[model samples]
Target: MSAPADSSALLQTPLNALHLELGARMVPFAGYSMPVQYPEGLMAEHHHTRRSAGLFDVSHMGQLLLSGPDAAAAFESLMPVDVIGLGVNKQRYGLLLNDAGGIIDDLMFVNRGDHIYVVVNGACKHGDLAHIQARIGGRCTITPQFDRALLALQGPLAVSALQRLLPGVENLVFMTGHGFNWNGADLYVTRSGYTGEDGFEISVPAASADAFARALLAQPEVKPIGLGARNSLRLEAGLCLYGNDIDTTTTPVEAALNWAMQKVRRTGGERAGGFPGADVVLAQLDGTRPLMRKRVGLVALERVPVREHVELQSLDGAKIGEVTSGLLGPSADKPVAMGYVSPELAAAGTRVNALVRGKAVPMEVAPMPFVPNRYYRG
Candidate 1:
């Protein structure tokens, strides 16, 4: 996909100079001139991550802290997740929705005991904050942690590598985090990542980011990975990339993210139908209103790979859907994609055709996480 076409100068991450020093191929992404790849290409970086650990500079993401007694309730007014019930230090994936039931953005929220901490997508961060402030600022204190840098350490060996720097981090199973003193710098490290691997996302002071990244890279198991690898990794793991697999026009139900909604917000529950779009979302969840179409995973049956926006047609030449995200999955050794289609055609094992270059390429509705997830939930 083409980067945003605005003529404005791109922003730079705190690790921008470090990326250049490491021979990164910089490209404009989400208003930032960030590295898409490095000396090692995408494929190598990907496989290396699956086998060992990959370090990613995710400082471009927005980090915000919400404090005050009304933080949970104010935040809960936005999405349907049980924010008030979210346990301390436990993070949950959530969606921001419009009143019309369309998704505004997806984010990770953690109940930090004393406050609520959230990480949102880079491109939508400013608007997301503005919306939150306009709606809930009177109740909660919203502070953007721009002075902090975010980093991801992911793969099968991620725990071992991280434990070397900060012991007891391995004790933080998936979806949990807490403040720690690492090399004398305060760090909030979460045992969670986008790659579907057993990994961690660490938030540190921007001034200490470069040095910390260097320290991690010095480990034999960790190597610097760029956005090119990052995209492929998350796609293979069946994770959605905001604006691609999901957007303002897509609802959480249509996007197959219904699991993100908690029981407390469902029918006959304590907080039922209180969040934005709750009426629409609950109708779909309770089968009061069936969804017309649902997002599904697709795997090309042939060696030829397909790209996004390619029309999916029935065998008789009727369009059913369009590919939202597609790529030659390195782990699958085949083209994998995800898109929305009629409810009947959303089942796994269903057959469809993708129109590529005016010809139809056969595909199957396969299960997601084209690569198996290895999260350490235990």
Candidate 2:
């Protein structure tokens, strides 16, 4: 395992040199040096991704393995998702909860036979590991896979570009995963990703990451994307970012992630719903009391991009909501955003006003996926 750095000065991934060579404007994000945008700027990068293909280096994320005689039992002791029932190679999106039922973080768990492979947010990696460690109670082993690099190939042309190199990867359906060899490097490829487009996330050894990324970019349709475009792309796709979209202050029900919870977990024995904060989480499951509606898509009428925590109000002056993630939608040619609001105002088409730079900006509650998701859901 690679130990975390002692200082906060920006860490670099294996692809750091590749990004600099492309003339990307490097920015510090989640304690790592990352490209915020390229010579094309954020707007162009955003548009290019929607129309073509974009490659992203997400190696800053933490990858880990949990395996032992009691791996499944130990896993169920922490997260709200069902680990025992997860079929091999299937991926499940779930949340890590505090004892009070508030989400500590959201993560993806993949069953890799005897052990489970986990990927967590980069910013919360250390805390997440500590949380899992303290609760496992000698039932399982927690091994951090710092030697791996994660890459996301997203957008309409993603399948074509990746298939051109890997040959036959286009057969993977969404949320399913498999192991493959690419240019002498082993990869764990998943037909799923953060951006709401047809894509794959490939996990490879850190040493081979840069070369693999360069190979993918060598294709005509693929371009190197930066964090700036990645943020806008996910927002447009209606995906949530940890820390901003959700955190320890919110529940899955409020975040509209109730579907991620298994039915058995909701009704099984005392131990079934026995994870931390089960009372609050299960209560939200039983009835819709004290709902904290997660914001979906919002269309800003003004040119300025609405940012986080901006107050939202009704046309008649009644306070309505606040923005969580808002920005210009280069694809829609308008500004878009998302925020929490009273349930009554959470319905689609509800008219609202965003306090943008102190002036009222007309906006509306629109259906999410600001653009339709092109995921290969088969």
Candidate 3:
């Protein structure tokens, strides 16, 4: 087993040299030296992906292969998601929770016929793997694929660009996956991504990552994208950023992620309350107890942008909540934000105040995906 990352030591992704050569501005993130932005900058990269395809190096995220007949059931013991119900080649969003109903991490799992493939947050992957292995080592094998690198080619033109390299890639629908041979290595291609656009995540050999990314970048519709644009894109799509938006202190329901909780895990289902935090999580789902605060989207009527950790207040000057993630949405061309506030204030059209520099800046609670989602369902 690999030791924990030291405080000052920074790990490098398989595509580190590619990013540097492409003139990406590097920064420390999730204990790795990663690209924060590229030469075209965040704004350009954001808009480019919206209009065309942008290739992203997400190799820092953990990829694991959970094998054995009991893998699904054993995996379910650690999270609130219905792993057994996931069909072959299908994928689902999952919440990893603690015993007290707070989120340990949010992840995505794919059923690969004989085994399950998982992708976890870059920062939480190590701890998440250790947790899973410790809890279910007797039932199944959790093998971390450290030798693989993940790439996300995202945007409206992602399909066309990807199809140029691998024909028939456009045939895949949203949340579906298939294994393909690329560059003489077995690759797993999933028609899913975090940008809320129609895209795909490619899992390839770490040794081939640079060449794979270069091949994608050579396409007319593709360009190299960095982390800065990725953050803004996900924010506009109302997706949560692990530590900033959700942590051990936040529950799935409180984070407006009830959709990620499968029906089987809720009250009155066949297999209810077996996983971690099922008591509190299912109770929240059943509405037996009222929820105090909930995550909601906000749109700035004013042009000024609000940032994370800023206090949110009610019209009466009472602090209701605080911003978890906020930024100027490039696609929406407006300041968009997501934060926690009293449930009563979480609805659309509700007026609220953000304390910016000790002054109350007014905004409205708006429905998310501030821009529409363009996932291909077929």
Candidate 4:
């Protein structure tokens, strides 16, 4: 996919210099020069994160705060997820959809008392912001928090390392967030991350980000991670990537993200029917149409890395689907991938095949997260 075409200069995160010093291979992503891998390579970095701790620079993402008397009302008009019922300090994954029900982007939305804070994927940030701004009308105030850098500290040792710098950081439970002080600087800490592990994603003031990141890496278990490892880790956990695994052409029903939609957002709710794609989304919710299922998981064969657009076929050579994302999982120690398929063929253990290098390889429709998730529940 092409990066944003705006003539504005690419924005740099506070930790850009640190990444360069660590021998990171920089690449253009979301209009910013970002690291895709380091000297350790993707496999090594991916294993390091699962076994110890890894830090990621996600500053390219867009952060916004919605504040107004009708913030919940305004939000309900853009996405199908329930906002009014969201508890403070809790975070929920949701999608921003266009009027026709096409996905604008997937995002993490946190309810903070009077204001709603959201973090969207970097590649879709501009388009997401523009869509939200145009439809928000005069009911709410949309404020972008561009003066912050987002850092993900993910792994089993994440809490221990973070607690050493910011006491009481371990108090946060899964999917929860809180405002805290680190070295006397204000920080927004959320018990969330892309990797399926116990972790925290902290939003720190731009100026202090570099200093804070340096402090974290000073610990024994903490190490710098890059986008290459990030992708492999998430794929092993069966998580979706914005443009690849999902996009405007897909729906939550097809993407296996129905859990994100709350009961209040159903057709019966007071304001549930006003959001974009309400008709189609509601119909799918009501089961008025056949839902095509797309699952994210691993393949058994160790020979090749599954590439996107590769056709998925039935055992008898009938084409049934296509791959969206694929790679060798450092944690799984094998080739892992995700693809879309017919709903009847989407069940776990269902026999299937994938065409790779002009040859059909035997594969099975397996359950996701090849490895179980280890998020801290308490």
Which candidate leads in lDDT?
1
Task: For candidate 2, list the clashing residue pairs, or say none.
Answer: 99-277, 101-277
Residue 180, candidate 1: alpha-carbon lDDT:
81
Better of 1 and 3 by lDDT: 1
lDDT score of model 2?
0.85
Q: Write the per-residue lDDT of candidate 3 for residues 257-282, one digit (tens) a residue.
A: 98887777775666767888888888
For each candidate, give its TM-score against the true structure: 0.97, 0.93, 0.97, 0.95
- Tell me the deviation in Å of residue 262 in model 4: 1.0
Q: Give the TM-score of candidate 2.
A: 0.93
Off by over 4 Å in 4: 1-9, 296-298
Tens digit per residue, CA lDDT, model 2, 1-378: 122444366788889899989999887777888888999888888878888899998998989899998898788878788888888888888789998887888888888887888999888898999999989948899999966999999888999899887887888888878888887888888888887888999999988898889989999999988999899889988888888888888888788778788887887666569889888888888884567666567888668788888999988978877899989887767788888887778888888899877899888898888878898977
Backbone clashes in model 4, listed as residue pairs: 101-277
Model 1 TM: 0.97
The best-first sequence of candidates by lDDT reads 1, 3, 4, 2
Residues 60-125 of candidate 4 have per-residue lDDT tens digits of 998999999899778877888888888999999988987767788999989999899999988888
The window of 10 residues in a row where model 3 has the poorest summed lDDT is 1-10
Model 3: colliding residue pairs? none
- Model 3 stretches with alpha carbons more than 4 Å out: 1-8
Q: Local distance difference test, per candidate?
A: 0.90, 0.85, 0.89, 0.85
What are the candidates' C-alpha RMSDs?
A: 1.3, 2.9, 2.3, 2.0
Point out the higher-scoring one by TM-score: 1 or 2: 1
Worst 10 contiguous positions by lDDT, candidate 1:
1-10
